[model samples]
Target: MTTKHLNLKFSVKDTDAIRNMAKSGRTAYAIALWFIRQGRPVATDEVLRVCDDMGVKVRKSA
Candidate 1:
């Protein structure tokens, strides 16, 4: 099989939008880590709840 390349173009507005989204994702990841480090089920539950509220779907890979 041959490798395929994809071409994508982002306008200024699109760049800004993705930047904000990436920033939010980073913040969410940090908060989740903090919750996990608390060693409390409640904290972890809260993190899952927030993720659900934000429509984040996680799947385990085998």
Candidate 2:
């Protein structure tokens, strides 16, 4: 069996765009998934903060 992992990378421009989207009321999950689709790593803290500021409640899974 063989396993491979994705190497996520992002540029300054990408971060800026993500931040803009976050500020514009985009959901954290949506934004994070967007970066994942592009093979980029999203900053979790930033996303969580944005969600908090925008009153996006994150549900806990059991």
Candidate 3:
């Protein structure tokens, strides 16, 4: 199996968009669309921050 990876940095506007999507309860959709549009992944930490802002609990893997 081959795993493809990319290193990406988010712009100010992109960060703002993530937060806005989180606030509007559409974080997943926003992130997915961004990936489809840019062919890159958003920062995982940015996603976690959005969850934090929404008070969503994230559990670690065992």
TM-score of every model versus the real structure: 0.29, 0.46, 0.44
- Which of the numbered candidates is closest to the native, going by highest TM-score? 2
Leading candidate by lDDT: 2
Error of 3 at 13 (Å): 0.6
Off by over 4 Å in 2: 1-9, 41-46, 49-62
- What is the lDDT for 60 in model 3? 19
Runs with alpha carbons beyond 4 Å of true place in candidate 1? 1-31, 35-42, 59-62
Model 2 residue 53 CA deviation in Å: 13
CA lDDT of every candidate: 0.38, 0.54, 0.51
Candidate 2 structure quality by residue, lDDT tens digits, 1-62 = 11132223434565456567766666667777777787866666545654454445432211
Q: What tens-digit string does per-residue lDDT give for candidate 1 at 1-62?
A: 11122213333453343345434554434444543565622233443344344355422111
For model 1, where is the 10-residue window of minimal lDDT?
1-10
Tens digit per residue, CA lDDT, model 3, 1-62: 11132314545565566656655666554565565577875555555654455465432111
A best-first ranking of the candidates according to their TM-score comes to 2, 3, 1
- What shift in Å separates residue 15 of candidate 1 from its native position after superposition? 20
